[model samples]
Target: MRIGELARRSGVSERSLRYYETQGLLQSERTSGGHRHYAESAVDRVIRIQTLYAAGLNSKKIAKLLPCMRDADGRPNEIATPTLVNELTTERDRIDRMITDLLRSRDVLDEVIDTAADGATTDPASLARRR
Candidate 1:
């Protein structure tokens, strides 16, 4: 299919698709007239790229990791070098920390909301000023 069709099917913008090609995260063939043509599997490839990006992997990292990716399970097909394995492990740990921090923040917000709902929001500072 053409770039437009791939973009529509993958729900990624054409600009992003071009950027992926430029970044070597995606592949396409050029026609005799120099128009880009992609295979049907390009749809799955685009989705995979988007998924990696969504997981906070940059283009360079995604490019490096893409070749090692297996199916859609986020597993490595072959044994990665120690350095690459460490890098990916670090990224996963960072994501975990981010999730933990978000959960903590959400818990705080929930407490505040509950307090307000219980009508315990009378301003202590206002009371002091009145005194």
Candidate 2:
């Protein structure tokens, strides 16, 4: 497909697709007339790239991880280095901590709601004192 079709199918912008190509996260071929063509798998590739970006991995890190990903052919590909795995694990842990903290905050807000529903006018100073 053409770049525009790829972008539409992948839900990624055209500029991002071109940037991914430049970053070696994606590949494309040029036609005789110099128009860029992408394989059907490019849509999946773009989704994977976006996932990695959302996971806090930079393009350079993703480039390394890409070699570890394999096609349906079951061919062995390069594995992620221990260092990269460690970094990813640490980031996951941090995200987990943030989630836990947010949940605790939500619980506290729930308590405030209960108190308010009970006709308790929560004194700001009392809340600060509790904190």
Choose the strongest candidate by TM-score.
Answer: 1
Q: Which segments of candidate 1 are over 4 A away from where they belong?
A: 71-78, 120-131
> What are the models' TM-scores?
0.83, 0.75
Residue 107 Cα positional deviation in candidate 1, in Å, after optimal superposition: 0.7
Error of 1 at 78 (Å): 4.9
lDDT per residue for candidate 1 within 1-131, as digits (tens), equals 99999999999999999999999999999999998999998899899999889989999998888887775556656766788889999999999999999999999999999987555447776557668
Q: How accurate is candidate 2 locally (lDDT)?
A: 0.86
lDDT of 2 by residue, 1-131 (tens): 99999999999999999999999999999999998999988887899889989877789988988888875466647777899789778878987888899999999999988987664345776667667
Instruction: Give, for candidate 1, the lowest lDDT window spanning 10 residues.
Output: 71-80
What are the lDDT scores of the predictions, listed in order?
0.89, 0.86
Hey, what RMSD does candidate 1 come out at?
4.7
lDDT of 2 at 82: 91
Give the Cα-based TM-score of candidate 1 against the true structure. 0.83
